[model samples]
Target: MKRRVLIGLFGFNLLRQSSAHHQQHCLSFLPNPIKHCTSIRQSLPQGAMPNNVDARTMFSHIIKASKLRIISILMDNPCAEVIVVPVLSDNYAYILVDPDSKESLCVDPAEPRIVLEAAAERNVRLSAAFCTHKHHDHSGGNMELQRLLPGVEVYGSCYESVPGVTKGLSDGEIVKFGNLEIRCVKAACHTVGHMLYYVTNPGNPELQPILFTGDTVFIAGCGRFFEGSADMMVDIMRMLRGYRKDTLVYCGHEYTLRNLEFAKTVDPSDSVMSKLSWTERVLSMNMPTVPSTLEEVCTFVSSPTNSTLRFLISFQEFQYNPFMRAGDLKDAVNATSEVEAMAMLRSMKNRF
Candidate 1:
């Protein structure tokens, strides 16, 4: 009876491949890793699509993220069991939980009413608020929620006031709550001290690790450069790649469709084309596309094969791909030594 919704904003691309074209669309539905999430994983044979190794592998992994194991909590199924509440403009607030314990955490709350209503409906306690950064859209409801629910621990970056932030943490600090363990990562580019929260339940390691990557990282996209430099963001992304491949990524906004459109201009090809098509389908359904895995994200954004995609990809692009641990990619991003990534980001921002 728990209701949930997932939202995603993919990279932007203007080229619309004919919908009628019979190119094998990788359409395996990953189960909703939220309360209303319902998905089944299907694996298509490899090497099926020419010019799209990254898309094929990435989508395949995404379907895997949707596959549920044994449901030990609220519902009798294994899938994403949470709620997506829309907040300021394009942002979304999420309620993540461990069904069996009835313990839950709120991610980037923008409005208290939506969270309070969801909590009341389930008769569950809101023990923690995991914030991605200090932006208002992501943390506007923090203070309100704290006022409404006494004792809910608010977690965020050490650099800014995250509304209800009860704990000021640094990178690599791990906190335990209920059956979950969250690793705090310093994702400083979006905000000088922005942080991404990665959560995992020790009791169910099979469940993918979930990352609340606020404005720093997005589905098929990344946040606009603000406080930190491009190299800083790149280093942070490399650190994220250290986690398991199946980690689930829950970001702050719904800009995936538009992000993908922009990516096409940078790298116009079949890989971007197919992925954009898939993004359109998700948007069409009006479903949230968060809770994506690290592996899938890396495949789409970090793989060297999509060099053209790199031009359109901002230095913040590193925020989305944690698998670039080698640091070699950072060099590529910094190749144009004379020109600062932040300066380039500023130029792009002016255009917008």
Candidate 2:
């Protein structure tokens, strides 16, 4: 009895989890979605083999099956797609797959059993697990996942310890995942080791840049400064504000509606109103509103001076997130600096 192995080489390269509680989970498996990417993937590729192929004969059929159906699959779809796995109530962890090479990685595998099962179903290997912070919901499954996925690289911040961080990263450091270039940013507000991973694919312009803000920044809101001060958060916002305008933000928690409500309580700008309406629509469909563009987050809707250009340019120079635009906020108008304004704003949010 022999096995036949078929390896499909799509263009050049080929291919690329964990488990947790039995909560209400949703699997969003996007396969090189043109609408989605126009964002990220992580790993190399391995094609699916024929059903009749036996274990021993599988290796023998590799070269023969190299030009099979995967070619058409890859040819039709050349960009990467993210598999959004909802874990632990409203928390989200992502799996980005590189189309050329099936190399993939998971972000915040809260439950190794659940995460690994999802990845196995997709035929993608877990090359790495990236932990944004040391929180139980985010990095609690690190050691377990490491045990499940032997030789897998687990990355975290160098400042504070993450649960099972094999690699301690610093700010401005670059990590390469196949074609994706990930830049580590140490945002030490939520937790001392709290970090953000920003990804950019220069090879594929079709995908937009991605920023994984783990409890540091959320859609229409920023996180409460637990370990750090308002000044520290202001600094983080100052640095992140400089990212590419089109960068898509994927945050840790699904707190958009609540954050939007808080935003209205503070500013109630046109952008906040529009964002409120949009968030409701997305939530109605039970979709995750994780990825908002950096441009949208940074630019708040302000009254336009030019009536004709109002439609084209509706955003003000201030940020949509009240904490991000503390200086421009009516609540914080009396504050001296952005740092002071941020402090005043967070104090208000803490009470609210």
Candidate 3:
């Protein structure tokens, strides 16, 4: 009698598993079907399905029934929205809104009123403010924004003296706004406590990552070394270069035309520069020339060798940058190292 009882228990367990499998298959065929059948299987209560039905035929029928529903579900969610708000003179502030949640975060809001107005116009509730550094032009509106939207979190570098900072962030720290993830990168050069924000959509291949480079980097030029050394700037540049090639860069200012003009002085014969210069001139009259990819910037400043004006369309500006230029300048001032070159360039730019 004991042997018979043990066999009976074993058989019951097999029957339960078979029933669960059959239920999953039946659910697939049902009208108004659930999304992700795997999830449905895991959510099933014990003993939900009987073991007598044929699961294979049910699964096939479910697939045929749900084809249209699957397509409709896949088409529902769109990419998140990023709105650019121009602030003082050339400074820019960005408002990022999650498509699903409608929750938003502001980046480097120099003017609180403008940011607030923009958010209101878009019907998004501003939830946080992310400051890149302590510069008044970048973090000036932090306090005002805090006052306007009470309880809205303010995030800034732990090392920086950002105004109205509620949370101090460090290098490699990750912050989330809905489904979007933002990675904080330490980029101390233009200022000692500067940080860059890299935003990405995990598990979503359709959306590309974007970089919010405050004042550390510009379109064709880099920020002047305000409180750091040339070596520090080099380190930051190298770090930025390691990001994914397709990453979109949204910088702090509308200095692309000016930076590209300066780049022309460095490599006058570059054909690509000539084309881009003209393009920027036309675009500036109507729209902003931002959201440039890392790949485009890298190509624009890549080092070239033994080429004519056409072949030299893309040339690295590092050696041409008074700060990154090695050896002697026209005045016989020698910069023996990369750091020295950057120092010399910074001093010259100050005078220029």
- Off-target runs (Cα >4 Å) in candidate 1 are 1-80, 296-352
lDDT of 1 by residue, 1-352 (tens): 2322232211111111123643211121223333221221122223222343221122212212122211110111222345555555678777776645668788887776666665555456788888877878877778888888888788888877666788888988998877678788887877887888777767656555667788877765667677866677556655765777666667788877776675564444455566567567546644455555555333232223333322221112323321222132224335343234434433443364
lDDT of candidate 2 over 1-352, digit per residue (tens): 2112223321221222223633445455423312222111111122132233222220100111232222111111113446666777788888777655678999998877677767776578889988999889999989999899999999999888788999999988999899888889889888877889988766766445777887898887788787999889988888877886657678888998998788898888887877777677557645566567666332211122322211222121234678778767744447878788888888878887
TM-score per candidate, chains pooled: 0.66, 0.73, 0.66
Arrange candidates by lDDT, highest first: which order?
2, 3, 1
lDDT of each: 0.55, 0.66, 0.59
CA shift of 78, model 1, Å: 7.7
State the lDDT at 52 in candidate 3: 36
On TM-score, the candidate that comes out on top is 2
Best by lDDT: 2
User: Would you list the clashing residue pairs of candidate 3?
Assistant: 301-316, 302-316, 323-341
Model 2 misplaced regions, further than 4 Å: 1-23, 30-80, 204-207, 296-319, 330-333
Q: Could you tell me the lDDT of residue 20 within candidate 2? A: 68
The model with the greater lDDT, 1 or 3, is 3
